[model samples]
Target: VRQAMVLTNNPDKLRALAAGGVEIAGRQALYGSLNDHNHRYLSAKAERAGHWLDEVLDTRSSRD
Candidate 1:
């Protein structure tokens, strides 16, 4: 299985992507260059996604 993450400030776009079977990792409200907060937020989101992916892979491996 493949997972996708979308970084957008628009709620509509987020919803549309989610409706389209895209997994929403996080939403970015800030525009332009990334600030410390945005960076931290994105990092946390990525970490969470990584953990989730690890769990999925582990499950699949166990099944196999």
Candidate 2:
């Protein structure tokens, strides 16, 4: 659960990280050199991530 939580939180940052295929860092979904810099600059990243967390983070039945 914690692993899922952490991976989902941090977006992949290629420059800042290595052994790269896909990861969560820079707090935004990054591929290639192109990146969505968090909603304002990267609305898609924000929306997708927000949606993902929304589905996962709901307290109603999450613990189950």
Q: Spell out the clash pairs found in candidate 2.
A: 10-24, 10-25, 11-24, 11-25, 11-27, 12-25
Q: What are the per-residue Cα lDDT tens digits for candidate 1 across 1-64?
A: 1345655544566667778787777654444444444555545543654322233233434665
- Of the candidates shown, which would achieve the greatest TM-score relative to the real structure? 1
lDDT of 2: 0.34
What TM-score do all the candidates reach, one by one? 0.38, 0.19
Q: What is the lDDT of residue 42 in candidate 2?
A: 35
**Best candidate per lDDT, number?**
1
Model 2: lDDT of residue 46: 45
List model 2 lDDT by residue over 1-64, tens digit each: 1111133333333322444334423344223222234224333444664433333233324455
lDDT against the true structure, each candidate: 0.51, 0.34
